[model samples]
Target: MTLLSLFTQARTYLKHRPYPVLLMAATPGSSFAALPGAQAPTRGTGTSFLQTFQNYAFDGFTLIGLCLCAFGIILVGRHALGVYHEIHMGKAKWADLGSTAVVGVCLIGVTIYLVTTASNIL
Candidate 1:
């Protein structure tokens, strides 16, 4: 109902769903799994320690990037929906709306930059 309650609900939701935020903050290495000299000797084996580690590391990076992008999209959508709801209910002021819009745009820009940079590195 009230602005404070709305914010509190959002905060609670974020607190509960922290994995996305964690993934968004992750900084996995840039190297791919099968580097020229990094591959284990027993390449055709079921599972070698080096191969497994490399595979997991590469997968972690990919997963983190995907999660970060998804989180950013979800965050922007949630904020936009919240703003729309507030406006529809006549509870959002012009200044509040403007500030929210600015923050959302900045967030989207940063998210795009991060995803693009990560993609390029990989």
Candidate 2:
């Protein structure tokens, strides 16, 4: 089978098994323990609700970044599972390639967003 076939299969699998796949993808965040003393620096700054909202919007961008990265990793894992199935059947070699390439593209987009952050000083 061609590389395109593998990608097609991966896409079909993702489309059909979205719930379990998404659940597995989200599982990693479960192990992330909250750190102590991680409160905002402005907690006692006596800011109004509006100021607090603005601070959360700014600081919360990191959360968005983390979610995007997690999504990409999940996609890669889903694709790997498909490849594993195909391998056991003694079929195509390109099945996993398509899923991994798409994952690479996702990583590139996430990297671009991270690098272009408004607060990036470096």
Candidate 3:
């Protein structure tokens, strides 16, 4: 396959990953049902799609989750780029390369926490 095609597939795959899906769904205008297993709020006339969506999307937990997921993707991608440069161009210092891997792992951990906790919070 062409390099561009590979890149496109990679991007598409990343966007659909669970963390990214949760992050995107947390954005305003996205739909949210009462989170699974949560007791529904009593006594409301019921919520419009937009309102229900906004309510969850703007909540603190979802916002934090989205941030974490986004940071994870960026860090991981940056680390990969560093590795590529180190291998092909020999332009990155060993310490810089190593630091990228460290940051990437940390970001992944944080992302997992944020995503799982956000689901519970909803």
Q: What's the C-alpha lDDT at position 120 in model 1?
A: 60
Off by over 4 Å in 2: 1-38, 41-48, 94-122
Candidate 2: residue 56 Cα off by (Å): 1.3
* lDDT score of residue 111 within candidate 1: 86
RMSD each, Å: 19.9, 20.1, 17.5
lDDT of 3: 0.71
How well is each residue in 5-116 modelled by candidate 3, as lDDT tens digits? 9999988898778797777878755454545575433323246876665555546556677776887788699767868687677676777767877877887887788687
In model 3, which regions exceed 4 Å deviation? 1-71
**What digit string (tens of lDDT, one per residue) describes model 2 on residues 3-120?**
9999999999999989989899897887576546557633342368787766666567756766766776677677677777787788847746676667767776766677467446
- Give the local distance difference test score of model 1: 0.76
Q: Compared with the true structure, what per-residue lDDT tens digits does model 1 show for residues 12-92?
A: 989999998777666344344445665432324236778766656665787788898889889887887888789879998
lDDT of each: 0.76, 0.69, 0.71
Candidate 3 clashes between residue pairs 3 or more apart in a chain or in different chains: none
